[model samples]
Target: MQASQLSRVLVVGASAAGLTTVESLRRKGHTGPITVLGEEPHAPYDRPPLSKQVLSGAWEPERAALRTREALSGLDAEFVFGDPAVALDTAARTVRTRSGRDLAADVVVIATGVRARQLPGQDDQEGVHTLRTLDDALALRAGLLAAERLVVVGEGVLGSEIAATARTLGLDVTLAGPLAAPMALQVGPLVSGLLADLHTERGVRLRLGTGVAGLDSRDGRVTGVRLATGEALPADVVAVSIGAVPATQWLEGSGLTLDNGVVCDSRCRAADGIYAVGDVARWYHEGLGRLIRLENRTNATEQAAAVADAVLGDDRPYTPVPYFWTDQYDARLQVHGFLPADAEVDVVEGDPTARRFVARYRSEGRVTGVLGWNMPKQTRLRRQEIADAVAAAPAH
Candidate 1:
């Protein structure tokens, strides 16, 4: 399809990526009809603050709003809120909604994102929670205030942030996860150890190296979790941040390759006149020479802009350096590049003992990534260096 030939563009989500796509299209001189379909009843809101500021009572839920009512109205887009795209026909270029409404468009952007993963029998309990939506944050915040002991059942970014915020609320918090150390996959062993020490020093108990076997409940509220180690941890509240899966079940039999996410080309194009972005898209990366799907907020916006460019006839490759950030207690950790859980890392600046440091991750003796623990300026300065190193290094 040609850029000028485009008429109506349908965005299947109302989250960051989808809204940014709508904004980008307008900014790029696309004078076309844009309709944003949202599955949630509430307006689009920032998600990162849900686990930290919103839970800690530092930021009200409304503070996470992405745009004001007037700002959204200025975009000149029709919003079909509280309805989801249940199916799509690529040949017909039509999307079927849950209410049996058929909407056809000249182009489609899939930014459905992901949903929180839950454990078996978790819904049988009441006090258990997950922090993904505004309602989830509100419920968890109330549970945090009323509970004496809280167990966060995933030591990843969400769980760690919630544990830290719970600690600030004076709740006896325990962090349980399968990882040997917290955030080992994100930063590195050195920084992970530093984070572990920070949590321990803040009076948050760590229960690492095992997953939850089962959850115990009484009177419809979760009491505690039974560990795989055959030990029971008591808790008055539980937040299961086990992770999330792409919300692509609606695309079943839609002829899209569905793996961890909707598979797309390097340009973020899934099919003719179709594009994917955000956590629901697993696009091939020209720089990394691999397929990557990132869940970070920055990645969502970057990919959305790239998709918008693609829609407007920019044939450039959509490759961006992966970046993510997490705030726990008073520390803000930022990372750029891919450092898997098993990636070998060596500190190149400062020391982890000082509560501030920078670590460079290397694969096959070449720097591939860098992480900053309160070293924002230094880390930002070294990004170019790492990109150069990655370009010069031999492909693995």
Candidate 2:
């Protein structure tokens, strides 16, 4: 079906990706009916701020709104909030909701995103929390306000950010993870080592290089985190920032490929008339010659645009240089493209000691990624290198 030929569009998961798909379709001159199904009762809101601004009380919950009420109303899309999609029939292009409503559309875009992974017995503990949704952030903020000491499990981006935000909010925060340093797997050793210093200098304790055993609770309230080495770190509140898994439970029997996420073609199409966007999509990357899924906020809109084009009968492959940014303490880190664990990183611009620099990552003699620390403009300029490298890469 062509753009104008699409009779009705159904977007499952009304977060950033789903909402953007709706907006993009309309912007691209598709006047056909659009319906967005969301699991959350709230309108589509940004998720990045939930870990920092919302958690620190710096920004009101409403400030994270991706679009104002008037803007959303102007979109002319029917939004069914709080109705989670429970089942999908790819053959019929129909989605059955938890509320027993079957929404059928000519095209169905899956943007259900991912849910935060939790430690064992996390839900049974009162003080143990995971920061994924808006409600989780608010509840954690409230808990932090009353707590004195906080232990953040999993020292990745989310865990590090949560520790930074909570520490800024006057909580004695300790970050624990199995990695050698925070974001070790993401940004690699050199930068993650610097992150360790940053966290320590900011009074955030680091309990790295150890795996979490479980939560120790008293009276159904979390008291501390037990490490694999039999060491325990006491906490008034515990935040688990372990990774997340793609939210594809509803599509289990839908006959669509589901690996770490909904596997799709290079154009983000899972099947005929069915596509996926955002973190829920593990689409083939022609440039990298592999299936990749990005969990950052940027992918939500970028992939949505790609899927929108695909739905409109555009055959261009949806290959993009992945991008993500993180703000912790006084540092803002930006990354473009892939950063393999063994990638050789070099200071391309500015000095690392100054905490304002750009690092370029190369693997197998090919520029694969760029890292920017507090230099957004220069980093963006350097991003062209990654783009050029991606273009030069031979497709499989």
Candidate 3:
């Protein structure tokens, strides 16, 4: 297949991955028709800042946009705003949108990202929120300003970041989760322990290894979390960041693999002329010899580019060294490769006690991952090492 062979391309989800696919296609000399359908009415924007600057009131919502009118104009693609795709017909090569419009296409790229998972028994409440979209950040920011006590459930990157930002804003925030330490799944126990210490030192209460028995509220407004241990922690605001569920429900009958996300081949092809990218795509990694899905901003862009190439008839396998970063309080953590909580750790540079260091994670004598805390320069330089380690990972 070539650019000429593709007459029209339909990209679902007008997000970073979807917009990047359109840009990549145009840059690769693709002159075919392209249509982008977004669920949100706002223009595509960067989501990383929603948990940090936006929540902290340091950056406006417009500043987080991925493209301005001028930038999007150069892509020469049809933009469909506020209309979400509702169904996919793999055999007929068509898509149905919520507006009752059936779109035909020569190729389709599904970039439907994930949505934040809410806790059970949680409903639309004044003080309860989940940070995923710009609207979420705006609402949470306002909620934070008015509330004196904040309870953040789930101590993952998003929860921890929100806690840090809330604490910086002078809110009494209690960070609670089932994990022994925050971000232990991403950087191992040693680094996670240091993060626990950092948050405790910054006046953010830590309530690890706890489950919410219920949410206390007044007149349908969440006020605090009631622990399963028969204790109540009072709060004025609540944020749940447990995890995300891929937005792949619309693909249910499309004959596509839906395990965690839209499972794709090495080339990111989900089916005969269809592809998937971003957080909703769970593609096979040749290096890892396993199926993996990443929810990071960096992986979204890289995978979109690879999906674009694959749609253009390039069958090169997409194999990237997994990377993610989080800035909590005064600590900045960057990681390359995969680091499970149980992996053995080896100090690479600096020291954890100093709150600034880099460490390599190993499994069965092979360097499987790397972690950097407040070591941005060193972290960027360690990518090659991660790639090398991935290439040398043992066969399944």
Candidate 4:
């Protein structure tokens, strides 16, 4: 079916996904009134560097924005900042912002991205922080500069990066998580074990298989965290980043499926006249025959492009491979494609002790994913091979 020529398109969320969707719409010849609403006070910007560059105080928040006002103004798209979406009236085709303004649109794309999951009863305490937005990073960075003891909760990509960053600032840092190692979900058990060893060698306390019960605070400032085992880890600051939930609280009453994230077909379309993208959208994989939600920036841009095509009468679904990267303590790790839990892992080159290598994950002799440490070129080649294989697979 040919999509109606979009005249009034409202994109809620001004980050990578929302901005990309609007830009794609304009590039595809949709010269309608496109209004982009962002809860962040700043315009859309890049986020990958927030932990490495911005948190180190080497870069400012402006450097992270994807597009400047001049670039956005050139497209004739209206930009609204600092007003968070409070509710969505899908039936009325309007959205209500916290500022008491109603935004009407012929089509609405929800790109309200996820935020870092904060610890309950601790998230609001001073010196306890979560890093997702620019403001969050600024606060955490400030704390890190003066902090003597830093406790990072979670061994995921963000948490590891934060631990590395804290150590770079000469802070005594401890990395703790529920898992036995770091990046176990993606790089698998073996690689995660090596990573734990690397952190320990660098004088960073790697506390694995432990979970936080609560944050101990006095006078509204965090003093330490209590462990699930009834032990205490004293810290001047704590950063919790277990995972992120979709920013779909405003669409709670909207008549669309909300399972973990907004469920959408390949093209990013959800309910009638509505679409969801970024970390907030759960996508259906035809090959895997399952719904998957990805938090990578690449997926966000690809899905946003698909959303633009869907809006312009194209039915192309986002079927790209998932890829992510992390930088910890001078080591760079990159991965492409999804590796099944049962997949066999192959250590192609480099030893964990040497700290540079390529690993390939395969299932039944067919490559499923590739992990690279200082071998980005090889990783990309293997990833492309997997993508080709998936595309060439026969129809069921």
Instruction: Give the best candidate by TM-score.
Output: 2
**Stretches of candidate 2 above 4 Å error?**
none
The TM-scores of all predictions, comma-separated, are 0.97, 0.99, 0.98, 0.96
lDDT (C-alpha) at residue 353 in model 3: 87
Query: Of the candidates numbered 3 and 4, which has the greater lDDT value?
Result: 3
lDDT of 1 by residue, 51-91 (tens): 88888899988899999999999999999989999998987
**Model with the higher TM-score, candidate 2 or 4:** 2
Best by the lDDT measure: 2
lDDT of 3 by residue, 172-284 (tens): 98988888888776676788888898999999899888777778888888878988888788998899998999999998888888999999988988898899999999999
The residue pairs found clashing in candidate 2 are none
User: Which of candidates 1 and 2 is the stronger one according to lDDT?
Assistant: 2
91-189, model 4: which lDDT tens digit per residue?
Answer: 777999999999999899999999778788875689998889888899999888878999999898888888888888888988888888877766788
| lDDT values, one for every candidate | 0.89, 0.94, 0.89, 0.85
Q: Is candidate 1 or candidate 2 better by TM-score?
A: 2
Q: Which residue pairs show backbone clashes in model 1?
A: none
Give the per-residue Cα lDDT of candidate 3 at 101. 98
Model 3 alpha-carbon miss at residue 303, Å: 0.5
